[model samples]
Target: MPHTKFPQIIVFDVNETLLDITTLEPLFDRVFSDRRILREWFAQLILYSQTMTLSGIYIPFGDLGVGTLRMVADIHQVTIEESDIAELKERMSTMPAHPDVIPALTRLRDAGLRLVTLTNSASGASPTPMDKAGLSHFFERTFSVETTSKFKPSPETYHLVARELSVETSDLCLVACHLWDTIGAQAAGCHGAFLTRYGNAMLPAPGVPVPDLVASELTVLADQIIGRQ
Candidate 1:
């Protein structure tokens, strides 16, 4: 493969990209008998978040998660209480980072790359996911789509990061597990690297741009970035 040019600023996507949501599997099991319900709930959550953004409706990501969980519960004919939702939210705020995250981030930082995070998470959530995961110190800044009232896969959201950093779109490279996210970044003229984590793969869409870099994990992605430099 051809080596990709290094990006001055590396933008990271949170949630499943850096942190492991599977850590909440036990909590999910309590709310529904089927293990597949967790996956469905997350899919619905992302779908609703995108729907709200496209409709010009702004809702905090946390609220969307809770609402989607209730919707999922209703669909499966499962009864869930407010307390159950609260507990899930609590666990979400403190999710653990995947094992490879810290070392990979350290490698990138050590190589003199600027690292920052962009997430669909709410603006005022205490102990933001990064803080709880003990990964906040690695980033130079943290961003949320809440400021733009749009979610990932929206051109404006990616542009907002470039504008905030006073950098041109080409100077930024988004590293994410979701194909839609990388496609959105590339659409906005930023470079992208895709991490094909569990349940994620490159979409064979003809018109969409494929990411310049693809790796199975963050560590490998870091090595690719560093090797190219």
Candidate 2:
């Protein structure tokens, strides 16, 4: 499909959209016995982040991650030790990028699109995950929701990116695997592209702002965007 318009700045969501977090399956299996708990843990991490935002409480994403892991462990009657938390954090900081990420990012950058990252990770973390993933060179900047003390899917988080870039919200496009994130960007008057990676799908709500582009992978989306140019 053709893009309606190309964005001046393409903002990326770091976690699963770009990085392959499946590498942690072994850790999850060792800790939770059921590797599926990794999915549950991540889902809870996002849920608690949003809940904290809605409740006017703000905590670093890393803190929320560890806390959510403990919560998930308790729910499953598993005992979680500090070592387990440390190990998880260590692995999280160094996830590898999805194989398609670097190529797609290069394609967009070669087309003169400004690329950047916007993640819910906190500022002052030892090593930003993108940098550890070796994908930092592809971006012009990396933003964290911690800077605004708000989690993503919040209008303020999306607005912060536009503000930092000194551009109108309409000139920014958020590319993410999360439908709520794209919906939030569109609601904030920015454009959005959805990467329909495995286990991710667009929302079926009639009135929600549909993404400007939707593709099965980042390379496909990049191709469409480049074609528009």
Candidate 3:
């Protein structure tokens, strides 16, 4: 993090970054008889979300999830019943936080960093996945790209966060497990800390802006950020 200065605020990414999405494996196995389809479905969800954002389209994240699940079923030539879809939606909103999440967040909070969340998931829901996971109290606020009708990697989404907090993009640090997400924040003039969670890693290219910090786990990244401070 030598090239990156300490940040005034830390914005987190949810989903796989904070929550344990693997919990859906059982549902995928029950429906498709292949638990690995959970990974494909998640990739589809992210891919289509970015596709929608780039095409200047906006829809609720939940709708896209349902559509992505169906798309996966169609691709695998599997039949997903209404019950399966209902189960997917229900499980998504109840997944537990990753074991590393609380300890890492506790470390950051104890370090006195202004912690908040900026997710593609829509806000204003009474019991968001974050709230359902009992992690809502750790954040000062939860931001949704729905506020700007865009998704992550879109400059507007990052800019919306900066504007809402009355801070320059440079003063914020986005900590996310997805490279495209951290890259997006950096491109938007914010610092980035990339967490190399499962199925994700840095894209090695001359054009890609390297994250300020890279760690394989959230706890490691949290320690690095605290050590940097």
Model 2 Cα displacement at 203 (Å)?
A: 1.5
Candidate 3 has an lDDT of 0.89
Q: Residue-pair clashes per candidate, as listed? A: 0, 0, 0
Preferred candidate (TM-score higher): 2 or 3: 3
Model 2: lDDT of residue 144 = 90
lDDT of 2 by residue, 107-195 (tens): 99988999988899876554677878788888988899988899999999988989998987888889999998999888888888899
Model 1 lDDT per residue over 1-229, tens place? 2324668699999999998888778877887866667788888988999999889998899899989898888888989897988788878887899999999999999999999999998666567778889999999989899889999889998888899999877888899999989988898888899999988898886787889899998999999888867
Q: Please give the CA lDDT of all the candidate structures.
A: 0.88, 0.87, 0.89
Ordered from best to worst TM-score, the candidate numbers read 3, 1, 2
Worst 10 residues of 2 by lDDT: 1-10
What is the per-residue lDDT of model 3 for residues 1-229, given as tens digits with 9 covering 90 to 100?
2335678699999988999889999999998888988999988898999999899899989899999999888998989899988998898889899989999999999999999899888774678788888899999988999999998989999899889999988888999999999999999998999998888987988989899989997899999988877
- Which sections of candidate 3 miss by over 4 Å? 1-4
Model 2 stretches with alpha carbons more than 4 Å out: 1-4, 125-127
Q: For model 1, how big is the CA root-mean-square deviation? A: 2.0
